[model samples]
Target chain A: MLGIDDPLIWGVYILCILSMILCVVYGLINWNRGEEAEVQEIAEEEAWEEEEEKMQSEELGL
Target chain B: MDLMILNLVILVYLLATLYLGYRGWKATKDSEGYMVAGRKTHPYIMAMSYGATFISTSAIVGFGGTAAKFGMGLLWLTFLNIFVGIFIAFVIYGKATRKMGHNLNAMTFPELLGRRFESRFIQVASGLVIFLGMPLYASVVLIGAARFLETTLAINFDLALLVYSVIIAAYVIWGGLRGVMYTDAMQGTIMFLGMAVLLFETYSRLGGVTLAHQALTNMAPLVPADLAAMGHTGWTSMPVLGSPWWWTLVSTIVLGVGIGVLAMPQLVVRFMTVKSNRELNRGVLVGGIFILMMTGVAFAVGALSNVFFLNTRGMIATAVESNVDSIIPVYINATMPEWFIYVFMLTLLAAAMSTSSSQFHTQGTAIGRDIYETLTGQKGGRSILLTRIGVSTAVIMAVILGYYLPGNVIARGTAVFFGLCAAAFLPMYTLGLFWRRTTRAGASAGLIGGTLVTVFMYLFVHKAESAPLGIAKMVLGRDVLITQMPWPVVDPMLIALPISLVLTVLVSLITRPPPERHLDLCFRGMKKG
Candidate 1:
């Protein structure tokens, strides 16, 4: 068997592991902020659909 | 022997793929929901699915076998995948693509490009190209896993392909991307654990982890004299300076997958499912870790497979097997104790199923969503249903192709798949994102030009099997055609990419500008009703 403990191989391993953690940390932060942005953006982009909903509501007199 | 149990395990896993697809079908709603899961994908699920789809059986079977042959050199791909594939994909491609998608209210990659470029024709053509091309990829994934199954379980080829296609198609067809996302999370988990166990077991088998590499490194000079004559580098060393080995490693595998990830349509569409830059950022970390473990373990173990080979057989790494594709399967079957073989088999199944379903879904969506709507009216009778029909047709195509494909040619076919996507999709995608002047004619011409050239070259020119006057050889009319030093660039990507890019730009500029309002409507439409 080869050296699984080789410094070079292990070094690369450590770098990848740490990089993964860093990426996740960024991801978690983004998740919190993204939902709110999504809500606002979806509403704005779907204005016509929302208007249609309103029209339907008025017709139903709900 | 536990081969019966192993067969049962594979049977169960195959059933699971199909079951998930069936469950997803119930959830599939309109075309939007069918294609994009109604844009309500969970971040965790999305991340796993991305990982699952990204790390295919090709990486496991083909690349793993490659590692067994080439030593640790192939591990560089796993590293590049995480750094470039996941992180850069998220930060660079993901963020911008998501923003543009939200801005344009887009759904598919073709939609993104078509809407972005104000060219329905470009979108339709891209969709058609992906629809036609991606199945060849799915079929290869089928063949890889099937070949592995054949070796492990002694199953017939036709049965295996049928089993493989049905399961993956079920999930992707039903739940659409959502189903894929859900199953991927689970499959990715299994894949990670499976690798970790295999790596550990391989370590223990080799008399501890540290001792293994010593054995591997100790024998690197066992490089074949014939290979060395042809500039083939041995596993013990990087390669001789200015050798073909160095170039192949650098060029085709490295640059091919590395830069190629940027253009992968399946990965591209994933950008839009998430809610924001934040979601993309979140996915970035999950994806990176997943890639690291998946690729890192695979490579480390693949290099270690050499140790397995040397210990099992008294042959040099390269001499042990001429075909690198068989190395991983052979090693797994020979080395691992009987019981856990099922686990590894499951891992291979997961990898293949994950990628296959994805390939099916991409092609299906491309044909159904893009072509149907473009050819006929979008709101015409049964447009969405017609798309479903496309998905069905794509699956049938995969079954037929999978059955007929000889196992040996599967690897080369995979190369062709990536090359085709690179030729067809990459140029237009980049241009669609960046080039404002890019016209429909420009994108179409480049697509047709690059795809036809790449395909022609591969069929008539690329003689990975024989010296059949490959395009480069014919053009240069010599032993050496195009010398891309340090990068053993066999793929026409190097050639095709530049040509496609130039054509895309030149044609766009030469053509009369599209209506200014049309262009502005697309660009400015971002987040604006």
Candidate 2:
């Protein structure tokens, strides 16, 4: 198809481009899907960070 | 090349890199920030860092040279790199890893595995493996870049090695992961642009894509007699099926590095850097395109370099340079303009630095967090300070090895690390994430057993590594334990990974499952609720 005789060679060559396009479409579709969950997760993450900090300081006898 | 012009360009680039490093240092507030960029990195930064760290100078110059010799068959590796390395990795593995790493507050790849299975032994052992094995890989990368500078700028090799190591060590030690990622993003952009231009120029010069490929295909009869004996068919075709060349291409290069990317410690930690699945989703787009441009173009241009050489020099690329490693560089010097040479130099510099920076970071964390803290039972604020010290130590070790190690080790160093990571880590890592029933005993057995098997194969069975290493020759009086044709050529990862996977599953079935409460904690928020 791309002037190469072997199907396997040209097959993978085309698959590389197709796989990249798949990534683009997947990204655009899922860009905004999990945003709300991220906000709540951030709050939990902050709490965990504070806990981690406290533990480290305690170990240091601060 | 104009020395003054090149120096000005490099000076400006280094200054910009230092500025980004300064920004990372200013932003780092705690150990978490140093380790995982505080788990709030922008999707673009995370994706670029991951891609840049994955595609090194070896991938471009080394593997690209192999493509030039072997033909377009190496494109299969590029396909696997994008589809598996980016798409499946970000979608399937990244989400699970990020959630679990957050739940466990895991800071490094080893720590992620350690906390998951509740096995300090696993963490410390994995850390030791990385600390010991990674220096060779890092040193090889260091040597590749230093050699380029030495040849291009007429600098002394020793001075180039010292200066390059010091530049990378400065930023990585001070700013940590944030510094690494920011620099990686900028470097990745340069790599993308460089490869894009090379591909465009090659195709246009060769009368577009189809004609260039057709020209190479028609030149099939010109295949050297020696290469044809080993299964060289044509530039646009796969090697003759079931031949020695086909096995090396399919088993070693394509499958070895292809599936091995899943288990690389430096790359796996990148999954933990982003905020959520949304960031990973966005990262997929950037990472896919970045890898496509980086490796896809390198492989394509590499094979097409034959066409360019034929038109200009009336000989094939291999005829021009007996050493395949020099094919890309020699081709560029012969064909590209002066300005493009400067740009390509930066591209090679960026590729080397980005990969080396990540290696140093991962090695340092392996020593500080995985080995030191786990062994000594110390988790105080001092560990981050120790990690910086570790980073410095890693840089010094790599520099020393670059000076000492023989030149031939560079090609084998990368494959050894990748094969080791796959056999040692992949089975346990994959099962630990998805199977709540995976036991600590099973994980441990897989980890240790897989490592031993891979080492044994390298020492005895794999002719490519063993013949050069010569441990088998000294001790056992054989170049390779098996002199059989295909058996000697098969990669250790192909043998060890399946054994490791079965060992994990069977042992887990026989042993007690991990605590349910811990399993719940690890798996929490992994699925979209």
Candidate 3:
């Protein structure tokens, strides 16, 4: 407790390092896994989106 | 000893740069290729360019000077740059931005947000903000380059300003954004090598870092009377609590730049250039490591400069001018071995030019995409050509403005560039990316409100001592009214960001929710699996 540095500083450093390691681990583990959770799924919605896209493509005539 | 030879070497560097950029002109045909290098820039080069452009002459010069004056305290900002600015930026922000960009088929920051929101109005407004704000930022960068050239080459600062701007313009006009990236890579390399070398050379010159550190510690009592009175302790020290230095470091350096990185348009657009999250993830490591080195080295050298000054002049550099910004350039020129001046010169030129080129390219695009594109309409190739012309016009305007600007050019310029980016871009950017309920009404109101308030605050409130007490003084306080506010009133970003965020959320809640389809499309449509 009476050492040359603050325990708070060392504690923050340890936490930051641990957090960084966990983040890296998560990224690697999830790399080969399937879909991202951030995205919402809609099998029905995709058909409508696809249909709209087709309509727009026809209208623009790419 | 001859300044002319140094000048000639600089000219050769300029010639080589222009030639390379013109070669790149062949690569730039469409907006995609012109803007983001066809989204295929390699991770290493992109990482270097990102690092190079981010660590400007201002960071090296101004922050170094600050380090010399303040000590190792400034190192915290560099850590933040690596962790938050680079690591978080790439993994968290970069992955999301790249995925969304590919989804929306967008080229610019404004385009990305506009496409995400399904609103051309947002794009146009964002573009307008960039056009209006980027030049001040660019000019700030230009002033930094000019100041270094002025001191080193012993020439008219105006001539240095003109020459530096022209080189940046030529490369940008010819290669577009790709050229900027190319030079940024080279500059980034030189910066890394230069900082590493400078670190070694400075340590050797000081007998060793530990010795230099002890000297600093022992010499604290010997601090210049004025600095001590002003609460400046030493390089190995910090300012007294509740002093100008403390506020400047805490609020300005840490908070100002720490949060400001997220909102910078030039940096934001960088995300759209990578291929995928894989590239982003890989590049983030490189960017983080590079930032760690670049910023770590700059502050290390800066802290040591005080020792260099005392050994040489027997006075702190700031004691000579009250402005601590000049400390780095002076210390480097004096202490480094004779042969290294050329290398140091090249190092600074690379740093300044890389940032300057990026600034010009981004500013030009802002004009083409935001202002001209809005008034005139894209209309195909005409839009492309107009955008090119806009790049040149913006560069010219910056050059002219740079030539005439007064005050401590470097400090003022950095304040302008970083300040403008903070005020005009940050608020809307953060909200646009993170705040889902962000409405167009809120977005536009935030954009205009943030920009105008920030600018008005900077010009009238910050400068009230020189100008009149524009509203803020009467409303805020007498100290602020007279430019005696002790600290800057309107960093613009701080105020704008809050207003923009609050307005965005409030308006989003009140307004009709976005079509929902676009939200689905933007947030989740990309099922790459």
Best candidate according to TM-score? 2
lDDT of 1 by residue, B1-529 (tens): 4767767876877688668655555554433423244345566667888888788878777767666656666666776788778887888777667767766767678888877766678778888878887777777777778767766776776776677667667656544444355556768887887777788888888888667767776765676677666554545345544566655555556566667777788778777656556567667867877887787777778778877777778775445756666667777788777656776777778777667766766776677567777667564345555656776787788778877765444445565667677777787776666566778888888888888777665544444522443554566664333334532336667677788888888998898766767656555534322
Fnat across every predicted model, in order: 0.43, 0.64, 0.00
Per-residue lDDT over A13-37 for candidate 2, one digit per residue giving the tens place of the 0 to 100 score? 9999999999888888987665435
TM-score of each: 0.81, 0.91, 0.80
Per-residue lDDT over B1-529 for candidate 3, one digit per residue giving the tens place of the 0 to 100 score: 5666667766776787677555444454433423244334566777787788788877887777767766666766776676778777777777777667666666678878777766677777777767666676677667766767776777787788878777777656544344355666766777787788888888878777567666666667777677677666655555676666655665556566766777677788777655446566656656766776677777777777766777878866566545565567777677665446666777677777677777766765666665566567654455556666767777887777776655444544554556556655665555656656666676666666667766665655554222443455455654354445454533444565576566666776788766666766666544321
Task: Supply the TM-score for candidate 2.
Answer: 0.91
Runs off by more than 4 Å, candidate 3: A1-62, B2-41, B180-182, B222-231, B320-325, B381-385, B407-412, B460-479, B482-492, B526-529
Query: Interface Cα RMSD per model, in Å?
Result: 7.6, 4.3, 8.6
Model 3 chain B scores worst on lDDT over the 10 consecutive residues at B30-39
Positional deviation of residue B251's Cα in model 1 after best superposition, in angstroms: 1.9
- lDDT-sorted candidate list, best first: 2, 1, 3
Give the candidate number with the greatest lDDT.
2
